[model samples]
Target: MAAREILADFPAGGPRGSWPAEEKAAELTRQGQPATVRMDLASDRFLVVPVGERS
Candidate 1:
């Protein structure tokens, strides 16, 4: 499998948790680019990555 590039990163367990990352991913989705949000427990940070084909 190919490695995914992280589009954004934010501190996890924040005032709203992963909501911030989710919002950024939603914007990317609205722009027609598939994306996802994940949390890194070790790093205590949220991550956003683009999915599917890369243009």
Candidate 2:
């Protein structure tokens, strides 16, 4: 898959209607990677994964 990142002040999880925060975290972990943060434009909230935990 293509590595896509937000250029705006977006968070880490995933894009809107793209993927769930928890699901992204799981996917990253499954891929031997880790997640960091997430931004919900609709909710105007940020989802942050703790260090060494989610990412």
Candidate 3:
């Protein structure tokens, strides 16, 4: 297994759904970091990580 570096995290309880996480990933991508979001069911949060860094 590979280790994924987390760039950011958003709570799953956000009223705006996953929009904030998506937007953050997009902003990171535009900034040249190339990020994406993944759900952590156990922790109940959205994780922002670099592309290809899926756990």
Candidate 4:
């Protein structure tokens, strides 16, 4: 699966249009943030969101 870094500029509260799910999760963790995997049925893509900080 594809992955990206979680940017501090990430929009809060879920992804808006055309955003990947898995990459989101991977990025969140990569950035030392807690995140959960999410699947977008509409785009058939996975995403991740930060649940908390690595602290």
Which candidate should be chosen as best, given TM-score against the real structure? Answer: 3
Q: What TM-score goes with each of the models?
A: 0.73, 0.34, 0.86, 0.37
Model-by-model lDDT, in order?
0.79, 0.50, 0.91, 0.50
Question: What is the per-residue lDDT of model 1 for residues 1-55, given as tens digits with 9 covering 90 to 100?
Answer: 5665889988876784448898999999999988888776878888888775342
Candidate 3 lDDT, tens digit per residue, 1-55?
A: 6677999999989884448898999999999999999999989999999999857
Whole-model alpha-carbon lDDT for candidate 2: 0.50
In candidate 2, position 27 carries an lDDT of 63
Identify the superior model by TM-score, candidate 1 or candidate 4: 1
Indicate the residue-level lDDT of 17 in model 2: 79
Error of 1 at 31 (Å): 0.7
* lDDT-superior candidate, 1 or 2: 1
Top of the candidates by lDDT = 3
Clashing residue pairs, backbone N/CA/C < 3 A, model 1: none
Measured by TM-score, how close is model 4 to the native structure? 0.37
Candidate 4: regions farther than 4 A off: 1-31, 52-55
Number of clashing residue pairs in every model? 0, 2, 0, 6
